[model samples]
Target: MAAQFATEAGDEPMNNALWRYALQVYSRPGVESLLLRLQDEFDADILQILAVLWANETALRISDEALNAPDYLAWRESMIQPLRDRRRACQRGEHGDLYELLKKAELEAERYGLGLLWTVLKDSPAASENCGLQGLMLLCNSEKECRELLQLAQP
Candidate 1:
């Protein structure tokens, strides 16, 4: 399913660990809807949530400093959100080609943001405790919804 969004080989950002992890997880059934729900209901940053899950999966601990990725935040605010708003606006209209272009641009911007997050988090310490999905709740609004997302990650 996620393959539908795949870019051609040699596209920038495909080599990043976070990008690969995100694609793998997002390809799972039910994962995409749950993620979109998290985004829409909580206004959560999907990349940050993915980063936290990636950290937990790889036994890494996300520090407060790493989470405060100023460059990524600035880029998301300036580039991603406006594109998302415009793309969504097209969803309510008939601008099909424009919508597709905006969607692609939004995804590329997100990939760039993920690279920034990886730079900050790549050196994080290993997790000494099992702070997995529970840790994600801190970045979400509703624990129940987060738990729902967590279930999809479980084997």
Candidate 2:
């Protein structure tokens, strides 16, 4: 299911740009660890954070309503979270192959989730250049962590 959506999503300019930005930024030093820490300690939604950051970079606006869209929430809770939980539960030494597969699936689920976010966010143009930053503030609670993400997200 996710593969099918991902294949189609690749054809969309917005999806391609967002996914590329996410992959590039996430591969940077400290980004993966920082995002995981935010998820574990702050209950942050990594996909939402990435989407907001992508919007900011591209000067697109993601509204609060789009951030809390019911379908996106449902997908995250039902698909992404469970895969993340299962992946985290499996010890790499004990179930290395299974763990790797689970991790890949989780990533795909997240990619699909980003596509979902883009569907709504595309319609809302940014009123100002800082709209993405404004949305990020609403999603992130800790100023320090938010700053850290911003620094890492920048090329």
Candidate 3:
């Protein structure tokens, strides 16, 4: 699948860009647990958080109007959320294999959703020359929490 989006022989495919971004960011120390906590406790959208991080890192901005766009919302509700629910539902069950499969599906759905989001924001202007961080800060309930998360995202 990665080959489908590759521009050069050794390049990472743009098709899996979001997945790759997610993997790199999530692998940062303390990030995975922090994201999970935010999701489980605050009902936060992990994909949205990731989108914000990606935008900030890439010197792009996702406008509120784009984030609330009807088509994106529809896709999230129809495609991403259901897979996430199914994956989470299997967490407490004895079906380890099924759980893993659902987890993979959910991640795929998230990557697809992110791709759709990127398409929407592709031509949008950058928030600033310095790469604004406010988009990601807004994802958290408090400044302190947002600060912590942002720190983790730092290279």
Candidate 4:
């Protein structure tokens, strides 16, 4: 984990840490795939939380091949019961409560051969040019991040 993530935490901001952690988790293999699957199959609460983190996710994906091959929807069905059971359910206004969010996301990403999550984040049009450095930082904690991210995602 240390080798995969950035050690020096300069004035980058909270999102930088989030991205650093995300990339480490993605490079671990199986983690991205599982998380992707969890995104679709998990629950709305989980999906909403993911949507929030994804809003500011800056972990740059190191692998290009892994980019076009994210088949998470398929893996969700096979995830262990304990993992699924852990899936969080959020109410509509209950968007910004994702402190332990990484646990589930990490578990899923580790389950798949996914790599370079931040790069995947690049796919988002909102992140264009901006790199979402601030957005990621501000929303590093709960639905506040999700709400902000969602606003950023919106046209």
Candidate 5:
């Protein structure tokens, strides 16, 4: 996230929007409530981290039936109003997490002394299009973040 991961080793700036959007999506209707109840800062950095976890987790839940429903896609779109870009990037590709992609990407980056590499993950990017498990990651994240999101849904 922009806050936590915002700074590189030298401490430069990155896209705060990604972090902000991350929280917006990460919080969702119920999750945000939990974070708020705990008095957590609604900043972008933490939110982005949460969003990343949420997006990755949700992408893993889609099934063939869910893939064919328009209404389902719409609902998913609604909940994930923010974090759309990162969510899409994570989602794109095949149906499996290709360790090869991650390895290749990371390797490619390191080739230039970039010292950075992100393995290409095989994802269908299905969630970006507005279908599949809507806000499905509404359940996954660090245990603490999960508890907060869960609390947000309290009656």
Candidate 6:
């Protein structure tokens, strides 16, 4: 299933360790729909959430400023958002091929953003404990919703 989203060979290998970790967490039951809601309704940045998860796993602290860095937002607005808009537009019609293409491009854009985030924290040391839940709470609409989403992300 993950192979469906992998970048082609000689394409810079976008599916790095952080991306793999995201796939693993995202594949957990109920996570997909919850994440979709977080994205569509709450304006949550999925890449930021994934980066925070990676930071928690690596014991790196990601400040709110870093998570909301201008570069990241600019990338999302220019790359991912346009693709997402096209994909959503295509979803309203019989444009399956176009939708699929847009979806792939959006995923690549997201991977690129995640890679940038990983680069920012590459030299940091691991923490003794994971702070994923706290990170999720910051992105989620409420504590209850965050807790529910965390439960879904966990096996």
What's the TM-score of each model vs. the native? Answer: 0.86, 0.86, 0.81, 0.28, 0.23, 0.81
Q: Summarize candidate 6's per-residue lDDT along 52-134 as a digit string, tens digits.
A: 76676556666677677777778888998998888887864688788888889998898887776655555455456667778
Residue 106 C-alpha lDDT in model 4: 42
Candidates' C-alpha lDDT: 0.77, 0.79, 0.69, 0.38, 0.34, 0.71
Model 4: per-residue Cα lDDT over 27-47, one tens digit each: 554545544544455332232
Minimal lDDT window, size 10, model 4: 60-69
**RMSD of every prediction:** 5.1, 5.3, 4.5, 12.5, 16.8, 5.1
Query: Which has the better TM-score: candidate 2, or candidate 3?
Result: 2
Q: Rank by lDDT, descending?
A: 2, 1, 6, 3, 4, 5
Model 4 per-residue lDDT at 145: 36
Per-residue lDDT tens digits for candidate 1, residues 89-135, read: 89635788899999999998888888888777766777897666666
Local lDDT at 24 for model 5? 50
Candidate 2 deviant stretches above 4 angstroms: 1-10, 13-15
- Candidate 4, residue 34: the lDDT equals 48
lDDT of residue 128 for candidate 2: 69
1-155: candidate 5 lDDT, tens digit per residue: 42233322442112232233343554477655554443344322223234333334334333333232444234334433333323345534562464445544432322211110011111334344422123323223345654455344322
lDDT of 3 by residue, 1-155 (tens): 32222222332323645456667889999998988888887777787787777666666667777666677688889988898888777864699899988888877777777777766655568666533356755665755666677789766
Of the candidates numbered 1 and 5, which has the greater lDDT value? 1
